[model samples]
Target: MKAIEYRLPKDFDKSFIVFQETGKFFPCPWHYHPEYEFVLVTKSTGRRMVGDHIGYFEEEDLVFMGSMLPHVWVNDAVYSSGQATHPADAIVVHFLDNFLGQDFLSVPEMEEFRKVLRLSERGMALKGRTRRKINTLLKQMPPMNGLQRLSTLLTIFDIMANTQEYDLLASPKFVQNFQYESSDRFRKVTEYIMQNFDQDISLPEIASVASMGVTAFCNFFKEQYRVTFVEYLNTVRIGHACKLLAENDRHVVEVAYECGFNNLANFNRQFKKFKNMTPTIYRKTLAI
Candidate 1:
């Protein structure tokens, strides 16, 4: 779905913004802003959507996104219900690409960082040791002021530029054609699918949600998202299935039905197609 544009609160005291957010749930809707972002989920379990990528997130999850990458973290039911033991919390940083200066990244000293920034255009899931290190640095950033904060930010980028412990999040196809257009129909269709993905939704039903005919909706969805509507729906369902499997020892057949796949064999086939492992193997690997 095309994301709505979001404006971060301006902080004139500093050239960038860094702070900790804690609440019953994360309140941001699916949206994008014109600044690079660093997000560390300090305390939460949820699903995160980065461009065309959808996946699970848990405590200490770290992601870096460049300007205009649509994303949001939707807390799990427990946290959102306000019944969890602890509130949701995260460390979030937002900065313009040229927050230092218009010509800063052009300097020779920034060559490596420039490369990392380019990679960030596709969004990145910082992992392993690099993820741990950046999480620590982000937790320390809110207290510092002036040049000290800027220096720490640069250090984080330097570490990221040098480390291979990361995975690109969004697909290149999605990133290449994404625009900041405002479309209510598009937004409504996406929201409908997300909210009702666990139920069987027919083509006519979803197209009706977009106020379009079946053929028109199919073409529109493909043009906007670079994927068929069914394809995108399956991606969401499979992502949620992965989350369910990781969080518990649910039987695969039960998970399949819960994720809106009525046929167990088809669910296994789709799971293997997207995750590169059978559902059983995928769950077994987690036990390791």
Candidate 2:
């Protein structure tokens, strides 16, 4: 989907905004904003799209997105259609890079924070102990004011900067080439891939979508996405396979085929390459 630029409400009273969102479903479309966002889903089950990455998310899902990163949270039909009794709830904080002043993060003492901010450009999924720690802190933030609130945010950043329990969501090329205009070639290719990744997409077919020959399109895709077309396709398929495995009581072979893999062995190999675990093991972890 094409991402629109979303302007967040400006708050003159505070440098940042922290509040809880409770509703039948999250209503934001695929969009980008200029503020860095820290969001924790306390109650929900759905898919999350950050740049070119697509994955399933549930309660305690914590993610940090840098300024202008494209993203969206799509609730499952049960929640969005109001067929479920419970509501979706999340704690979200939004702040600009210069929220504390442009010079604040430029200081020598803030070097680690600078690195963290740069890494966040790809969007980040916090996991393991870091996710748990940040979840606890965010739950306490909505009621805090002034220095207490600011300090809490800094503490969360510090924890994130120091931890290795996180995954970068978007590819480097996606972060570098994303533009708000929908007619751009990169956007078109991205849209095509996202919409058709579940089907058998040949290089020539996608090249035609981009109005290029197979060889030229392959080179262009690699240059624009920093990965071979086939590799990128497998990555997307494996990512979706992860969601299916986590959310469905399906066999590994079934999930693989559903994700566009023609053979179980290739699916297992590619899934391991991206996720570092077998599908069965990954599903078991979710059960745990």
Candidate 3:
């Protein structure tokens, strides 16, 4: 398995910046940076892996990732599988914690904004009215510069602070693995799992992909991802099941089989264990 690689910007001096990307195949491997990032998926649909979070993503999705949080957005098979109409489109903003200076957060006027940035450590998604507002701001991002860009960013934070619809993506225990220097290993493991998640995955098989012995691979994967290979496979399978439940009109048993679970009872058990709801309940919630 190969590691995930990211195409970083050429200029690294700026602490805060915003830019637009279109039709670029930058498979940013599971990596992180010192600066926090805000990404708006203006035109794309794919799977996102941020820290311990994994799920499908579509157009208009807005994500904020804190500094040092490993993440990546893999284009769906429809796109990378050589059938895409157009490449992914995105507006990305990156800024350091001190880009606005220490005094900015200390000021009484910016207390709410300060809190929002702190909460962003786990990653967040903007929803509903706030999403619409952010979309408008991002559409005008190309023309904005200097103070205008700074102000627009401030307005984005303000909107996020006031919005009631936002959810954290990563768990408290899902800390960044700074020691995982070789992103190739991470990318290879994940891509293999994503591609073969519908089949029975075994430690020996995955270890072979990593080209290491079973015990060595187990320790290495656990150290890097903080989850055993089997556990992570289950997470991916359950995530696929969730998507199938919401988007497909298949029977529960059929969905289970398609998602790689051998039996309906085992699928239901795992789904409820991870989602806290049965597959039927999950479908019902999505319908509403």
Give the best candidate by TM-score.
2
Candidate 1 Cα errors over 4 Å, as ranges: 177-288
Q: Estimate, for each residue in 137-224, the C-alpha lDDT of model 3 and write its tens digit.
A: 9778778767787788888878876766776665433542323234687668767887898898888999989888999999988765
TM-score for every candidate vs. truth?
A: 0.64, 0.65, 0.59
Per-residue accuracy of model 1 over 1-288 as CA lDDT, tens digit each: 347999888678789989889999999998999999999999989888787566789999999999988998999999988999999999999999788889998888887777677667768889999998888889998888778889999899789878878876664434543332338887687678878988999999999998899999999887664468887788778877877887899899999999999899999988777666788886775564
Question: lDDT of all predictions, in order shown?
Answer: 0.82, 0.82, 0.74
Which stretches of model 2 miss by more than 4 angstroms? 177-268, 275-288
Is candidate 1 or 3 superior in lDDT?
1
